[model samples]
Target: MPTTSSARLAALTVAAVCSAASTVVLSAPAHAQSVRVHDIQGTTRISPYAGRQVADVTGIVTGVRSYGSSKGFWMQDPSPDADPATSEGVFVFTSSAPKAAVGDAVTVSGTVTEYVPGGTSSGNQSLTEITRPKVTVVSSGNPVPAAVTVDAASVPGRYAPDGDSAANGSVNGLPLRPDRYALDFYESLEGMNVRVADVRVVGATDPYTELWVTVKPDENRNRRGGTVYGSYAAQNTGRLQIQSLGRAADFPEANVGDTLAGATAGPLDYNQYGGYTLVARELGALESGGLHRETTRAQLRGELAVATYNVENLDPSDDTFAAHAEAIVRHLSSPDIVSLEEIQDNSGATDDGTVAADETVGRLIDAIVAAGGPRYDWRGVDPADKTDGGEPGGNIRQVFLFNPGRVSFTDRPGGDATTATGVTEVRGKAALTVSPGRVDPADPAWANSRKPLAGEFVFRGRTVVVVANHFNSKGGDQGLTSQYQPPARGSETQRHLQAKAVNTFVRQILDVQKNADVVVLGDINDFEFSTTTRILEGDGELWSAVKSLPRSERYSYVYQGNSQALDQILVSPSIRRGDGVEYDSVHLNAEFHDQISDHDPQVLRFRP
Candidate 1:
């Protein structure tokens, strides 16, 4: 006969056991390792630390919050770091409305995932890596019980009041407890069931899908022997998450974070060799989608190519058109679609006292063609530059130039104001139309990006979409960080917004286009993982051309100590590996110390 306190604890213990048994399995990128998706030796059942998965973080629900249709509950250190590790508060969302709040400890297990750019406020950036939210609730704490401390290292492998010991451990990625980054202060929680806070995903792509959680100082790092747990719901993706569970704790319950005397979840299932195996389902999704693989061409086969370059403030000559034309020529080369960002209204004040919106494109075309490629008859520029370049009440920054024999104009170009939600207007980021040759709406994504410019192109009987863009730069009137899923503080707001815009535009436009094959080339002004770039990866179906480049050739520009993919050539799923398309980034500009425009040129070749 147990006392009232004992009975309550028993109930909690049962819930915890059940919660741990359930884990959700979803499609995502993987770690650079080949974690065997099986059980470990002598562990008797399944092992939770073998899969690229998440944990069922259960703790007192200290508080709750609201954000439009999405809401969240707060929890004190969900997973305590092994030592010296900092623990951020954990926030769990149910639906659009939060169910718990400060002091109301709860347990949730769901797939851990990255934030999509579409839902961001400051737009999107490439600064922050990834973040995950709570999707499922295993149990709710009324006045979320205070967490109990467990020193598994000093105490022993299986320390418990009743000789029942459990813990968790990690080989790679998990902070070694002495780090100053997010996971510092925690060695590893091998077996014990400890709640973690501020849980988020770090890596993407197929093999680097890793989860990072903020730990509390008192978190358990022991090696527990039982079924492990974690998850992030599919429908919830980055927002609503429900912790994974197996069989709703069949036994009695236990107190929050308490060292159980004889608690154990049965039939553990391990995968990937990490600390957790995903349960089959979580949150509102019975299933979800994963990476889609397709075959591409092996070689370019020497086809003529086209591309764009964003020459930042390309005013070459002091003699207006002559100097402007000459100075710009220093950075010029051969390409199809050459984009200009920051060209003077006048080629240097033009001949007439009035800088007739500087016909930079028209002149550059003459020089580049005179410089010789195939033919330079066609031309396309944004803001139309008829009035000499001032953007009315704004400034002119983006314009495009295409060789007539190489490509033709679509004339469906337009601009909009820049914001977290859509592309920029006022010359910040603009889009123009052109025909790659197929001359048909191969896909609906001819236009995509924060300030994307779309056009139609025909390649060897196959119609496709080509989008050119000049996104907001790292230097602009944007915040340090947008109010989005990324918790990174380093990336600028405008950068993030542009990233989100690219991501949202892709997912919203290309993802839905049935037969559309989309490709985007632009100066995103961000590094590979910058929050802005992340949106492109997380949401948009865009794949980086850099991935195809060797490490030495991966970088397009250099700034500060970091070399980034500021300029990129991305393609959608459908046209990923078409027969005749060839992609590459040409070094026409940039290197922290090198010459050329602040950016280089990216070229693509396909039969038209």
Candidate 2:
């Protein structure tokens, strides 16, 4: 549902164009009056008179947008509608520059339509609009409808309604519950002016001139000022996307927990990226949360530092290598070993037969060394052609980069890209039969997905088994702002299976040596409190290093206003109980617009 960063960027452009269209003015001849906006926007998700021509729809122009192909202006009825569920305002899609001005009492003749942004194939709900309009400015300088208040207490707890069983999980067929459902409340205020107060920024201000805020306080709120994406709790009930479409300046940069001091006024809108957004023209004063990019963690003398970072599909062709290298050196304190995910093949995303990532991995190592970090050695199993699901021929896989001077690779024979590595007893200690090997490469859980890359390293006379992983993503899951009730999370099923596979492998190492030092690190693609994480830590066999930090400082990623942990560093119980096992989520990325990756690197430091 357009959860990717690119999708957010695209939405930003679309919102900007639409906002420009809504605020700009043009000239048109007058036409006769027809239907009320409330009659067109009934108490349902879909317009009742969709596809029918309605004449003389009268209202005061509240907003005008004249920039994009889907240009429109918002109009609100001065009088009232008996049904509170029905909205008194509506958007008139002029399909060009709008010919109306704010506060102009206008009459329009048009066809009522439910135009789905991004078309019907996008799985997005349709927006009710009046298209092919004939506009008549009946009178100018009329008072517009007063904005309605939509704060935490006034907002409904529920987000969706259960539709008919035959409607395929959609609430489109259901009657509106404006006072009970957040989606219904938004639909009720569609095109009408509304104000949100006492709002806390849940999502950081992104490059797209948009931000996400929550009217209600969350349980896992970070002290630094962002809501932790804890287990699926409130379902983002109070979270709202704020798009300053018609503003003269870009929205100010904000971190999680920052507050908007005054009320933000705008018309509620539905778009492709997020389901419902506030197309704000006026934003209140922003109160800072004192959130800033964190500095690199200190590497202690006796501590062996380990970290996990998702490079967000790095390839030899991408120019982000140098910036990423600097972040690894300066922001992550040059960990002794780093688990890198999403290393693409040498040819990048090209669908060629080339599957090796030597060039891709080598360039990063060179960049890291050039950036004043340790000269590192790397090991990884290139996936079998394109069987691993990723950017097709890009063949994204996890790899380990270790500082050769500090740690030695336990290089045993029989390691390849496709063979599964087995645990064996060696000299009365836990050891992998092949030092750099795949963990159950052919396992069904890893079908069409990147397999776990297992490597054994020797640090200060002690052996540490590090398993690097990049599991399937949440690509197929429905967004929290979906029209479907209890949004589908189908992607978690694969992740759940993948977690079990990794957990079983960890169990194998523990069975050989109960006190074995094992660290599972990479882009796990799930939260610490998620089911996938719980399965990976089955029976407390391993401990998540993130929990080592206070509850308010455990996020490694941010999306749609929620700061969450997706990339994780989990250590076996022995490591957790060991001395000097400190953990930190280095926030050089994720919270900033000029980020190197969508994920923040996490480090676990301990003396084993």
Candidate 3:
């Protein structure tokens, strides 16, 4: 459930250290046979000698993590095995601060444990660690193993081998093919020291002192110097998360297009959040790429601009109101209608049963007006307390902000959190039974999730139906780097149902009056090519506008190191059948360290 990169890193480290807490320690025999690191880490994902005690394991310490709860030292065997599938390095987990230093020749005797980074339920690959260590300094100043260079040529082009069908798509039992797949290649060097020279920073440095770098610079490179994740097949093998083992304050703060100049070498560790990670022991200096925030051109006179921005849990207490206001006024070019997601209640997460967001919305509106933008009025139904899921008591919901000068909101009565809005023919025109109403809020698809908010607007004597949605996030889904091949996306079931319900509602509106201008937009939390999207675009009911751009320019969010489309805008056939529509996924956020929001706002302009 850790959302941020730093949180996941902390969680993984905590889980790894605590994995041996409940383990029953088994002492080795008096004359146990000496074992090499590769003997413990076999050709498979799981360690061969797991749950057994190994004595007299000889290796030279390569890196030492003395800080934090996960205090341990990474050691690499100078003498390696002939098999390329097995790793030469291993982590010696000490309950407290380790007494080992880098480059020290040491002998360790401990119970070999297959520590799953997140947990067994996470489907994350396990780390072969030696727990309950009995360390002895054999000699001083012995040379460490040479760091393996991880460049474009070293990492295989293929991502991972498909799992065995009989075992429910799990590759844990499969033999490691280091030369064939990138996942296998990384697993082959699981605990080994690896280096990447002058790697480009694809993911910006987050607050948790972690960033992402790619050895394959040219693979799916975007205009903004990011690796575009177009589909499930292309996992961008070279993208690896980098976390410095040094001080957090000393960690280099980098932007998306920057580069880590010189060699950044470290023990390759598999994390719960971002699969393969290089925990930097030899840190690199940050070289700026001069990346800057972008601005979109203002909407034309006849075009009504609509945009969607997930403000990252905006509330009255947040100091980001001014920055978000500037992003709306400057970067977004002041869209006529904007759908704001994650707008917390007036009390934020205080859990005082305050469901109203008037103060929060009012502060943002005031900031916009102060920033030379129009005084935008907002419309949204307050959800029943704790019914909507977000930050525990935040009560986050989708709210619509419209500029009255360009468009007018058609307010109808009898709309609330539990009320379901229906489309009806009024004077031979498509109309909502209750404007600013919930779309099938009672449906099971919306349980513990935000319901779709549908509203009617008048623009230049034409009626436009806009539905703002914040679908269920992909929280419980296994990541792309999961041990299971292709990974399981269990969270998609709810999203699939959500998409079906939205598509059904849109169909109802179009059935009432053909050629109705309906714009559906928000943080969909799924890829553009996903089944959820395909369901939303059922038959010919709706089409995603982000796909109108080239494949490289279709991303509104960045996760790990891949630029992906999570926030999107889809329009009905009436709106898509013309040449007047224009869409822009404004690159204001998601690529910089000082972003006001985590998601980039998407704008769609068209004549109704």
Report, for every candidate in turn, its global Cα lDDT versus the true structure.
Answer: 0.36, 0.81, 0.90
Worst 10 residues of 2 by lDDT: 20-29
Q: lDDT of model 2 at residue 508?
A: 94
Clashes of each: 143, 14, 0
RMSD of 3: 2.3
Candidate 3 residue 377 Cα shift, in angstroms, is 0.7
Cα-based lDDT at residue 523, candidate 2: 89
| TM-scores of the models, in the order given | 0.39, 0.88, 0.97
lDDT, residue 507, model 2: 99
After TM-score superposition, what is the CA distance of residue 469 in candidate 1 from its true location, in Å?
Answer: 1.8
- Taking the tens digit of each residue's C-alpha lDDT, what string does model 2 give over 424-514? 9999999999879999988898998899999999999999999999989898677776666667788899999999999999999999999
Q: Write the per-residue lDDT of candidate 1 for residues 26-60, one digit (tens) a residue.
A: 23434323211111101211123222343444555
Rank the models by TM-score, top first.
3, 2, 1
Top TM-score prediction, candidate number: 3
Worst 10 contiguous positions by lDDT, candidate 3: 22-31
Q: List residue ranges in candidate 2 displaced over 4 A.
A: 1-34, 118-123, 157-169, 197-200, 217-220, 247-263, 284-289
